[model samples]
Each structure stands twice: as structure tokens, then as C-alpha cells.
Target: MKEHHLKLNVLENSQAFLIEAVSKAIVAENDARNWQFAILNLVQSLELSLKSILAKKHPLFLYENIDNPKHTVSVTKAIERLENPMIGGVKFSEKEKKGMSSAIKLRNDITHHEFDFSVEYAKAQFLRVFGLIVHMFRHHFDIQITDYIDSNFIESLLEIEKSRVVLIEHANTRMQEEGVDSSLVWECSNCLCDSFVADKSKETCYVCGYQTSVEECGKCEDYFYSHDLRSIEHLFETDFCEGQTIVHNSFGYEPISICSDCYVAVQRDIDEQWQQRIEEDEYYHWSVE
Candidate 1:
């Protein structure tokens, strides 16, 4: 029981670390992409949670009466085997499993590849997993992680995540050995009808026909495939420059992917709009109109 309590404490602390890590990833500077670091931070949290359940050389999960050793049994051996998918671990129910597993898969998509938020997917996953993690933290630790994590820890994770991007280059070279460029690839949901995957052997989307000539292999980092595009939207969406794109690279993150020229153009327009709005707000105190 003492061991269980201690492990639970560790898990709580890890959860705190995760929530903080994700918050930092949100604001970090890097050239890789946006939202992914946050997504990866969440992934690390789930991995920690999944690994915690198997502390006893246990296959996924097994339970025992701490004092009555005879009560040890495989969790799956029970007809009541719990399945929780949000974290891709077994718990006790199909809903729990599906919710968690799907969240993890979404996190994996943006973390390990280039992806933008799907309003439908991102909001649902975030709300569910955040609730589930918080709930479990309370059940196990009698503490709340949101209060536990501090700004200092978040700042640290931001720095660490930035550093990790360096190692990614090496990881990409490794993928080159596999004849794929790890940079231009990602993993997406099976329901993808708008996009197609070229790396069937790895079952990942190359995601390369437009914004780049490089076909990235999601399974590993390696070489890139050459491609061509006629319109920027075919590869680079209009959103890329019009504040629709997010980028992560060695330099840091850009919330929008605009060329310096276009960025300046938009900034000028934005400045004018802000000034206009300010003047309007000052002079036109609105009545019900």
C-alpha cells in the first residue's frame, strides 16, 4: 500500500509536469511547427500514465491484494477487464478506452507530423483528456495538478523542448537511412479522404505534394521524396500567409507562415485596422443598434 501510494504520488507529479509542459510548448519558439510540441508534451504525459500501470512487470495491468498475495490475478483474466483508450491503456470500460486512445492518436498525429487543428478533434480530445487526467489525479493523489505546476517548470520544459528539436535533425538523418525524410512526414487518422499516404509500408502520410518537394516518412527520419506544385495553395495554403499557418523550425515557432514580405504587408494592414478600431471605439460609444 505504501508503494502504491508512492507510485500514485509520482504519477500526480508527472501529470503536473505534463500540464505545465504543454502550456510551455504552446508558447515556445522553434522552427518545427506549432501545436505539436504541446501535443508531444501531452503524449509524454500519457506515456507516463501508461507505464505507471505496469509497475509490477505486469502485462498492461494486474492487481493484487497487497497483504493477501493469493489474490494476485491478471486484470484481463477478470471478465471485467477495463479498457481506457484516451491513454491507450486498459482500465474498465469501452468509452474510457475509446476516448483516451483516440486522444493519444490525435496527439501522436500533430506531435510526430505536420497537422493543424481539426476543430472537431482537438476540442473534444483536449476537454476529455484534461478532465480524465484531472479526475485521476484527484482520485489517486488527493491533489490537483493545475495548482501543483508552477511557471518555472513550464519555462524549463519550453527550453528543453527547444533543445530537443536539435536532436530531431539527427533523427531525420536516421530516417534517411530508411530512405525517408522524417521531417516531411506524419501519422494521420484512417478517415483521411482529403489526403493520401505514400508510405504504405509504414502506413503513414507523406504529406509532400504541395508545401514542399520533400516526401517525409513518418515511420522514421531519412530521405525525402521530390515533388512539384503549381499553386501555393496546392502545397502552401492561403492560410499559410494569411495567418493560417504555424511553423516550428530550428529558429523557433511562427504562429503564421507568411513570407517576410507578406508578413510586413499584413502587419501594415493590421496596424491600420487597430488604429481605426481605437478611434471608432473612442468616438462611437455604441447603443443598441
Candidate 2:
């Protein structure tokens, strides 16, 4: 088999293990032990998936010396290297990066110290981890793991969802006690849960801790936000802003209405045109006369 195919098979096996771990964690009576093992397996799955992607690109990335067993890239190192690295047409989001970092930290804590673990926390982490896995499989490998989930597992997932709702309610109560506007809740993009308390002033989501300024897309007139596309003003300042405009909102501030998709399309088109021009030019001039 090709190296990429072998790496993909490894990723698939890791995902299968992750699914089993999650199912046991949710359905089993022992919360502490089950969650402990679940989290360990979760971290393992993430490591294997990341390493597989890196290995597909080049086996050297997974090992410092291909011949030596001792020399290998750590999980932390793999994550750091994958920062902003595009794989299979999908780029890792800042929220996903933060989630991975948080998972790693939690895993380390669980391994070293005797920390209090709750079903709610485990469920939340499961959602985040599972979401990442689904994204990678669907987008990166063009595979679907949904078929792997049996009916019993699906029922357990529903129970977990109910638990998550209760947790969100508790979170809202805590936010209210802390003088935060708990009424301003929004759906979290990361967990796809309606538990994200949006702080418009800070542009932060309290639930997932994601920070992004929401704006209406001028073309679609739909409100959208992106953690990655922060400095979009440069695009408007360039020739790409032929028909795009920044309009003053009711809040007395001008916000651009460029959605992430539109922004990407514009940038991609510009890059392709630039590359074509370079290819056509016999002698490209660097200095302006």
C-alpha cells in the first residue's frame, strides 16, 4: 500500500478506538475511571490522527531519524507544526487549535495529579474531540464515521446532549451571578451548542472561549464571524474592494460585511491571477522605475 493509504488506515483505526472509548465513557456507571480512560484514549486518537497526516506528507515529520525508535515527534510538537498548516483543503481553525491545546493540558493534568473529574466536563470534551474527528474524516479523507455509530451509541449521545443542556443552564446561572449578561447567548460554532454567551463588547464566546467579531456579509446579508479573518481591512484597501464597501452600523461604527467564504474566494482569485501573470512574464521587474 502507498504510505498515504497506510497513514489513513492508522487514522481510521484510531478513530474507531476513540468511538469505543467515548461510548464506554458515556454509558458506563463508573464516571471517574471511565472518563479517565476516555480522555487518555481521546488524546491518543488526536495524536495518531495528527501524526498520520504528518506522516502522509513525509514520514520524517513523525520521526527525527527513520531508523531510530527513540527519535519521534511529540504530540505537542506535532500540534505546533500543524499551526496554520492546510491539509486536504481544510485549514485548522484557531478555535480548533485552542481546543487541542486545552485537551492536551487536561490530559497532562489527569496523568500527573489526582484531579476532580465530572461527567459534564467529559461530555463537553467528547463533543469537541468528536467534532474535530468528524471534520477531519469528512473533509480531509472524504470519509464518514457516522456509519460507525450504532443505535445504542446514538441513544447515549442523546442522553449526553441532555446533560450538556443542564450544564449550559448552570453555566448561565453562574454567568448571571458574576454580573454577565446571560441572556445574550448564541450558538457556539465549535461545539454546535446554543450555550455560547456572546459578549458583544469583547466579541467573545463564554462557552468555548472563542473570540470573533460578528459582521453582516454585504453580499449575503447574513451575519457571520471568523476567528481567523481579523485583518480584513487590507483586502478592502487593495483593488479587491471594487464593489465591496464598509458601512456604518447602528452602533456608530463602520464594519465590513465580507464573509469568510467571500474573503477566501477573493484572495484565491487574486493569487491565481498573480501566479498567471508571473508565468506569462519573461522578465519580472521587482523595482518600480
Candidate 3:
């Protein structure tokens, strides 16, 4: 049988890390210094929880090099091992993997080097990592994560999550009820959520209250956030590589922002041109024959 006491110890340590993370996170809202440590503790909590899950299979799996067995595995390696068919066979979605990878990188940056993070972005990342641990506790261990942490601290975290969902839902509801055009709704540059409303007079994010003016795509003449447009420019250079001087072309074709539609249209035109050239070459060969 698996070492039941060892599993319990790992889980308790994981909860301790989470509790410490929560205390830091609460202070981090106003105190910038605490954000770094909060994130570190949060990642530590996630790492220990992952290790506990892996420990169920074998204790040696916790080590970075199982053959030598000196140090514990990093979060990334633990995740990779968990997904192995012979080891754990736990399936993680692409989105989950991306979030976890980002959290791990953030943890490494905070631990090894000086770093700065905006509070809003930090909170979003903390929640993402915490959600992963919650999933493991609830699904794998059949225990609610909220039951392990301080009720007051967890309430604040849950409130943040609830508010985020409500903001998106409110924006979507407005879109549907007001008969707003779907094209007018875009991803918010601030929160990276699909809650930005680009009305004619004003453009604003429903979630984060980030406001910016809307601009038309040069080629398509469709409205889009200024940041969303891709600027296309022509350049002239004598030597293409190896430290060559390059200048913007002054052939009266000013740099302009192109939307995705215009980009796709240009690609389609090029494809059609290539097809026409191929057909002409085939016809010439037939005539010569």
C-alpha cells in the first residue's frame, strides 16, 4: 500500500503554504512588496500538491533525477511526469498547461531575480494557479480547498473570482439585450478578456474600465482598437543583413494599420496570382507540344 502518512504530511504542508500565500495576498492589495512573496508561496503550494499526487505512485518520482534521488522535481517536470501514461496519466488541458507554465515562470523570476508586476495582473495569475490546486484537492482528494484555508481569506479570493465572472456576464448580457453588433465586442487590452465594447463615440473595457479610442483599419475601413491593428510599412535597404542601414520607403505609400481581414485578403490575392501564373505556364507548354 502507498505511504498514507507521507501523503497526509505533504498535503498539510501544501495547505500551510497556501495559508501563508493568502495572508500575503491580502496585504499585497495595498502593499507592493508582498506581491512577490505571495506569488512565490502560491507556486510553492501548487508544487507541493502536485508532488503529493505523484507520491501516490512512488516516492522516488518526487526527485528531480529519480536515478540519483537528491532533490525534488520542479513543477514543470512534475506536470510532465503526471501526464505520462505509465506514471500518472493525468490529463491537463492546453489552457491549464499555459497558465501553469506562466505561473511557474513568474515564480522562478521572483525567486531568482528582481521583478515588478502590476497588481491586477498578479492577482489574475495568482487566481489561475490557485484554481489548479483547488481542482486537484476537489477532484483527486475529494476535499474542498476552501475547507483547508481561512474562511475570511478564501472569501475575499472567491469574491474576486465572482466579480470577474459577473463583469463578463454583464457585458455579454448588455450586448445581447441592446442588440449590439457582435463585431463591436472585442478582447480588452487590459484584462485580456472578451469584454471590451467598442461603441462609435467611446471604446472601453467592461471588466477593467480601460478606455481607448477606436480607429478604422486602413484597408478594410472597419473599426478596431488602435492596438489591435497591425502597421504595414515598406523599407529600403542596401545590405539586408549583417548590420546594414535601412530606411523607410518614401514612395508616397504611408504606413497604415491593417486588420486581420485585410491581411487575409492580401494573402488570398497573392495565392490567386500564383495560381494564374501556374495555369499560364501549363497552357504555354501545351501549345508548344
Candidate 4:
């Protein structure tokens, strides 16, 4: 067998994958299967873009085992490494992270298992990943995304991106015209848009057709999306640890979730009480003096 040396042309490979991804995306409007492949290519392109950035920092940082140099790190590892302050120091918003994670899951479903996605839903997820590609190209790599893809393809992507805006705007107008309660609407966990209706009987997202169960808030007793609730933790005095010289023995009680609004109100009350205590303490100190 003839021996061959492996060479990693990360940036060039990223450009090529981007080109392929957009080409597939242009044709993907009519073909669902094409959309699946486009998603795969787009995720690969993004992974390579991240690797290219890390490689610029240090080639070894991209590898799982720096000494062996046989296998590279996974996309998840690459993202974590990018955020490391000592390394790339790249930051991503929670929404961006959610998008990347959803894309990776979609890619995995396409590659490793049976999957089904409507054209609109697939495009929505695809756009989320594509947004990251654009971000990495401009912010991290310092390159124009259009440089790799043709102008026509860029226009196609622009059109595709417009679908979400139109869908969201229309949904908003419909809700307003119908006189839907603002408290019943929420930002979707999937599409990250304010198009989810958390009705007591039905919880549905108009933008992405995402559905989940809703819960009643402990304070307001109003129904909200599951993600909108914040888990509440309380410290309780433990009977077992009583009389122990331990520094304020306390145990975390069972967690209970409260709606965002109620949590904010609770926090505000705590802040007011804390301020009052501080003022009283200061007055007492001044009186003693």
C-alpha cells in the first residue's frame, strides 16, 4: 500500500462547502431532499469556518488529542473552544447557540436516522444555521460571505430570509386584529419569534408549528410556556445539621418554577426589602454614633 500524508486545507474547504451549500439551497426550494442535503452542507461549512478560526489561533487546538493529531474536535467542542477567553474568545448569544444546536440535531437526524420536516420548517432551521455562517465569515474570519458565493445565490438567500419576516409580521397583525391578549403570546423556543400562543387549552407556535404543554404560574396562576418559567430554589434549615458549628447550615428545598413576570415582581420586592434593611441599619449606626 502506498502511504499518503494528510493535509487539512480548512479555510479553502470551508469556502468550497459554502459554495456547495448555497447551490443546493438555490435548488432546494422545490425539493425537500435537496433542503436536507443543503442543511448538512451548511452545517459542515459552519463547522469548517469555526475550525478555521481555531486553527488560526493554534492548529493543535482543533484536534481532540493534540499529541496524536489523528482526530479533530467535534462541533460542540469547537463552539466551547471558540468561547474560551484564552483561545478564540468568540462569543455567541443564547439564541445563536440554540440555533446552532437545533441545526446540529437536524443534521444528525438526516444522517443517522429517519427524519421528516415540512419545507417551511426545514427552511426555518436552515436559515438559523446560515445566519451563523454569515456571522463567522464576517466577524471571526474577516471575509465577505458573498465573495465565495455568486450574487444570484446571495439574492436567493435574501429572499429565503424574508420568508420568516413576512410570516412573523403577518402573524402579529392577525393576532392584533383578532384582539388576542398579549399575555397569551410568547417568543417561540424553536424560531425565537413572538408568535407562540400559550392558550390554556392549546399551546401552539404559528411561525414554526412548534407545540408544547403550558404550565400555570405559582404567583399569577396564569398559563405560560414551559420555557418562560424560572425554577425557584429556597434554602431551608436542616434538622439533621442543627447545633452543628457549620456556617449557617442550610439545604436547598425542592425547586418550583414561576412565570417570568412573577419572578421579576418577586425579585423587585426582594430588592426593596433589602434596600429598606440597609437604610434602617445605616440609621441605627448613625444614631449610635
Task: Compose the digit string of candidate 2's lDDT tens values, residues 1-289.
Answer: 5776768676777777778777676765447668777788878788788776677666666775557836667887776655635522336788797678778877888899877755545666767876787676676567676666676776776777776676667767767776875456666654445666556575555555555576657545565564434334554323425686643222221334467776676666656766676776734564432
- Whole-model lDDT, candidate 3? 0.79
Reference-based TM-score, model 4: 0.69
Ranking by TM-score: 4, 3, 2, 1
Q: For this target, which candidate reaches the highest lDDT against the unseen true structure?
A: 3
**Residue-wise lDDT of candidate 1 within 156-233, one digit each (tens)?**
544554443444455455556666644335422322212223454554432212222344322233434332111122
lDDT of 3 by residue, 135-183 (tens): 9988778989668887899888877778778877887887788787777
lDDT of 1 at 13: 52
What is the TM-score of each predicted model, taking all chains together? 0.35, 0.55, 0.65, 0.69
Name the lDDT of candidate 1. Answer: 0.46
User: Would you list the C-alpha lDDT of every candidate in the order shown?
Assistant: 0.46, 0.65, 0.79, 0.78
Q: After superposition, how far is residue 38 of candidate 4 from its true place, in Å?
A: 0.9
Model 2 lowest lDDT segment of ten: 246-255
RMSD to the hidden true structure, all candidates: 20.4, 12.4, 7.6, 9.8
The residue-by-residue lDDT of candidate 4 on 7-86, one tens digit each, is 24787788788789888988888578999889899889888888888887887887988899889999999999999999
Model 2: how far is 215 from its true place, Å?
31
Candidate 1 regions exceeding 4 Å error are 1-13, 25-32, 53-93, 111-116, 150-289
